[model samples]
Structure formats: C-alpha cells, structure tokens
Target: MNNQNSWKTLAVNLLAERTLLIVGIATVFTLLLLYPLFQMTPTLQASPNPPGEVFELQKDLNDKFPNSIHFTPFLLESLAGDVLTPNVLLEFKQRRQELFAKDAIGALAAGDLERQPYLVNYLDSETGVLMTGTHSILDPIEAGLIDIGTTLESASEEEVKLAVHRLISDPKTSAVLDFLSRHATHTPSTAMGHEIRLWVSPAMTFSVMTDNQKLGGGGLEIGVGGGPDVIAKEYLNRHIRDVMKEGSTSYAIWGIAIDANLEAQDEGKTAGIFIMFTVIGALLVVGLTLKSYWATAICGVGLGVLMIWLKGISSLIGLKSGLVIDLIVPIGMISLGVDFAVHALRRYKEELNKQYPPRMALKIGLSSVIGALILAMLTDSIAFLSNLSLHRSVIHFGSAAAMRFLLRSPF
Candidate 1:
C-alpha cells in the first residue's frame, strides 16, 4: 500500500513551500495543452478587425435578399469565355469537310474524280464585326463566267477580308449598343447617363458606399439625364427588394462562406475554448493542497465540474449573443476563460499556504481567505459582465472571462 504512492507526502509538502513557482509552471503547461485556446486577450473594448466588414455585408444581404443567383468574379469570366461557342466549332468543321470533298486527287484515288468539283478553298475570316449572306453579290464561280468575275476567284486574302467586313458591317450584333449605354466594359462601365453595374459574386464581404449609392440595378444607370438605363436600374432595385424581403439571401451566401470559416475539430478554436480543462485544473489544485483524495473529492469533483460548465456556458453566451460574435470569436473567448480560472486557483493556493499541516491550513485558509477573495471576485465579475453593454465585441469577451473564473470557485 505504501509502495503504491506517487512522490509520497514529503514531495507534495515541499511543493507547497514555493507554491507560486509550482503553480506558475504548472499553469503554463496546462495552458500549453490548452495553448491554442488562450488566444482571447483580455480587453475592456472590442476593436473590429478589418475583415469583419465582410460579415456585416453578408448579414445584410442574407436577411434581406434571396433567390438571386450569387455571381462570382471567376464564374462570370468562365461563363463569358465558354458561353455560345459551339457555333464557331461547327463552322470550322464545315470548312474542313468542304476541303476534303474538293480534293480531286483523293477523289480519283477513291474512283470518283470525274464527279468532283474543281478544288476551290474559300475562307472567310472576320476582320471586324463580320457578318454575311448579303455582300457585293459576286460568287467566285458565277463571276468567273465574265473576265472580271475571275478576279474574285483568285481573290487575295486582303480582298477577302475587306469583302467580309463590308458584308457584315450592318449585321444585327451590337446594333443595340446604340440604344444601350456606350460605356463598354466587360461588366458595364459608367458613361454619364449610364450606370456601371458590376454584379461581383460570392459577393464582397465588405461595405460598399460609393458616391453613386443608388438602389437600382435593372441596367445600372448614371449621368446628368439618365435614359433607358435609369429605368432599368429602378426595375432591378425593386426586383432585389422583393426577393430579399423573403429572407433567402443570407442562407444562400452563408452556405458558401461556411466552407471557408473554421471547422468543429479545428485546433484554432483553442484561441477561444476553455472548460473541462479548467475543471481538471481546479481538481489538480485541490489535490495538491488537501493531500487526501477525501479532501480533493469533497472540493473538486461535481462542484468543480459545475463551475467549468457554468463558466463555459457564460463564455458561449457572450460569443453567441449577437451578429457581432459569429463563429470565429468563440474560440478567442474560451481561451480567455482559462486564464481567469488559473488566477483564481493561484490565489486559493496562497491562502492555503498560511496555516500549519494540510488540514489546519485548509480550514484556516477557507475560513479566513475564501470569503473575502470570493466576494471580491463576485463584485469584479458583476462589473466585468456589465461590459456586454458596450458596442464593441470585447465587452462579451470580458463577461466570458469573468464567468469562467466564477466556475472554478466552490460557490
């Protein structure tokens, strides 16, 4: 039974002498095990990080709007690059087929030379806005009947380019540009009287308060006397409002953002997490001082557990109370709580050190120091928790830390 001992009573008795050093080193190691969570630095005020602006924008968009397809910069560029391009490939295929059909030598080798048409390669490439089917009305084969018609048969590439441009200059494409705004950016640009409406997607996570903060979007209008575009912008504005009032925007956007935020098992949460740890630590404190499982159990078991939970809950509440907390903040808040619990235990140790022998010292310490120290913490906690009233996020941080200290107390 004696051999089953860990360090004997003497070693622990010696530890109680330089109790502060022991506690300090142990506290640091304990925190290191929880090092990841101790990230929430104590603060009386919360200063917003620059990136938090993204969250505010996300909230506003989500609570107000939904159903509108969230466009992203990459998606837009990829879509533009790939859309409506099948026809170009098809045209190239037909050109290749025409060349294969006209190869007289190959036709003869295949026993059909007599039926083959003369090899004539006609390539029409666009110089600018090329369209066709209406031209100078000269077919190379038909024009070859007259001497001047032969000139087109052997037309130079330059002549072909000119002819193609002449035919397509009045094609239907871009004809509407005259009516639409001339501010031609890939995403429309602002040309006075025309609003530049760029629908960047995954949606920006920051504030957008430009000089031209119009709540319109049908076609993005600006200028001295806005025309059709102004009407279009008004239409999109109402369209967006009607959609947002239904509360679909935030969910759609947050779903995408959650992919980028921290995960449940992420070690980074050590920055804000504190709990079972504080309980374990509190037990360690009682064990070292009381010198008996009976004393430690009486002080540290379920009661210590309750303290850990209560304080953890308080930290959690502060983190979740408002739009400001979000998921990242809880990690920092919990870490802050651990610091509080460690300090509380340290003070408890100081009181325990004053009396002789473990039992008498604990009794005297509890009777003398616990009440005053506890009452002080209670007063401090109330004042600390009141910090939640402040606008900055740090207020809840202070409250969470205070609550964590309350948990380790026997009360």
Candidate 2:
C-alpha cells in the first residue's frame, strides 16, 4: 500500500513540525481567553420585540407614548376591623391623615407640590362629623350623649360596646364609609374587614390602608423617578430586605420587581453549581473511558475554549444574553465539545491499537471523524438559523454555537 505509506510519511512530517501546531493552539487560546476581558457585563432583557402585527402595534404604542408605560412598586399595609367600628375607623382615618400631611410637607419642601395635586374637599372641611369613633357620625352632645372622649373614660365595657354599635348602624356613618371605600383602594378581607388602597406618586407619597387580605397583607404604590427596576434594586429593595430581617412583623413589604431579581440571582447560583458538577463529571468520564490523560485534558480545554469564545463573540456582536441563553449555551457547548473530543480520541486509540505509528494514527483519527462532525454541525446550524426569525435570543445562541463548532473542529 504505497498510498498508505505516503500518508504515514506526510503525517510524520507534520508531527515533526511541532512549532506550527503549538503556535496555532497558543494563538487560539490567547484570543479566546483575552477577548472576554474587553467585554462589558451582559444585561438581561427578556421582552424584546417579536415579529408580526401585534409587535408592530406595540412598537407604535412605545413610540407614541414613550413615558406612559412604567413599573411602579407598591407596598400594602392592612389592619383588621369592622369598616364602621368607631375606634378602628378612627385609627385608620388618623393614619391616613398623618401620611397625607407628612407627604404634603415633604413634597412642598422639595418643590414637588407647589400647587396642591389633590382638590380641597369636604373631608378637609370643618364638619362636626368625626371620620371615626362613636361620635364619627354626629357631635357627641348633638347625639344626646356625653362627649365620647368623656364617656370612654367613665363608661363600662358594655356601654362602650353599645355606643360603638349605635355609631356603626348610623346612616351618616354608612355614607362616610361608602365614600371612603369608593375613593380608596378597598379590598375587604372578610365581611367585617375593610382595606384602604393608595397610590404612591413619583414624589414618594404612599396610600394608607391596611387589612390581612393576602400576601403582604396590603399594598402601597411607590412611583420612583427613573425606572422602577433601577430604583427598586439599588435603593428600595435593600431597605426592604433590611426592614424585613429586623424582626418587625407588624406589616409586610412586597416589591415584585425586587423579589424577581433576587430570585433570578438565586437561580443563577444554582445553575453555576450544576455547571461545575457537569464539568467535573465530564472530565472524569472522558479520562476513564479513553484511558488517556491527554485525551481528558484536551476535552476539558476544548470546552473551556468554546465557552470563552462564545462569551467573547456575544460581546463583539453586542448581544445581551437573556435567561434562556445563560441557561442553555454553557451546557450545550460543553456537551458538544465533549462529544467531538471523545469521538476523535476514540478513533485515534483504535488506529494506535492496530499498530499504526503515532503520527499516522493521529491523522487517521482526525480524518475519520471530521466529515461526520461537519455534517452534524451543518444540520445543527440549519436548525438554529431557522429560529432566527422568531427571537433575538435564537440569533445569539445559534450564531454562538455555529462559531464554537467551527473553532472546535481543529482540536
């Protein structure tokens, strides 16, 4: 077999020229490893515009009302009670007044409320009707009774109960409660419980209402200037977490955006743990099965190179990796690299066992696998490229995988 002998001679000559292979490997590794240093951290944005008519409509809406859409975080506080009970209603009304006054002062001082944003109304008028308590519906003396403040000091428990019941059943009391429930964000926990809901404006004003209705008990809306995502994560979220940990259970504070980011971070940590496990398992299995330390090292190095290259390419292309990319790409690349490396190494061992020279064995191993690998990669590329019309993430992952396959072929 003169052709076989010629092939063996060529392989030997190539192997003898170790400098070329070393230089090529060094250049590839250096480029793959160093490129990441110049890259910025990836931002995760999931809701990029998709194709089709609905997306076009959304784009138009965004253009027409640039500042109309926003994510405003809300905090809810609730207190349990009968909506018409004098003392409970009084306390709730007083809390609202306190919050309103405090916000008014703060906004005025900050020049945010130079003109009153809300109208002055009967609630602010000098009505003898207290918004809460036994005398909430009528003046204490006008109701044919001693002043409630005086009665509470001397009245027996039964008398106090009777007074509260009388006040709750009053028509005037029903009117005031109806007004509040209509104007406020009201969600009743039970037949006896009433809730007040308020929107927190951009000026950090919050609504005052509370009851044990659901998780977080009640909600308060806060409209922070700048994006809610940024403010909630950087400032509001930290404060809320600290407040939650301080062992104060009187009220619960919930920030949906903040909670989501924290949960994502947790999932990322878990994914990292699994990735490390996968890498180690791959290395051990390859080393044992191939029975060659060199093969195992090559598999590990190939995977590392593929990951670095994917990240580098992502940066160069200005693609932000979303949750899907982060979850899929690393695992995908590792499995692909290991598969290629195992096939190559196994073929090399088979050639060696047939008593072929080392250089000839290496050449045959590479030649035997390259055609099948290229065919598989072509099919994979088609599948990935077909998805490009659907989402940006598909474009990113598909392109990255294609590049990684190209880069790993030489190894």
lDDT tens per residue, model 2, 103-171: 344321111112222211223133335322111232321231353443433444334344434444455
> Whose lDDT is greatest here?
2
Q: Candidate 1 — what's its lDDT?
A: 0.35
lDDT of 1 by residue, 1-411 (tens): 553343433343444466678657644544443322233322111333323677567546654653122211111111222211222222322332443443323331111113332222222232122112111122221222232232433544333333323332335322322211223223443422334332222221111011112222222212212223233333332222222223321222111111111221133335233434554665576667545576456444435344335434543343422222323333333333333334444444665565466654544344444455567658766876777643344665565556555644433
Where does candidate 1 have its weakest 10-residue lDDT segment?
A: 69-78
Provide TM-scores for the models: 0.30, 0.58
Model 2 gets an lDDT of 0.48
Model 2 misplacement above 4 A? 1-33, 46-48, 51-53, 59-71, 74-247, 257-266
**Whole-model lDDT per candidate:** 0.35, 0.48
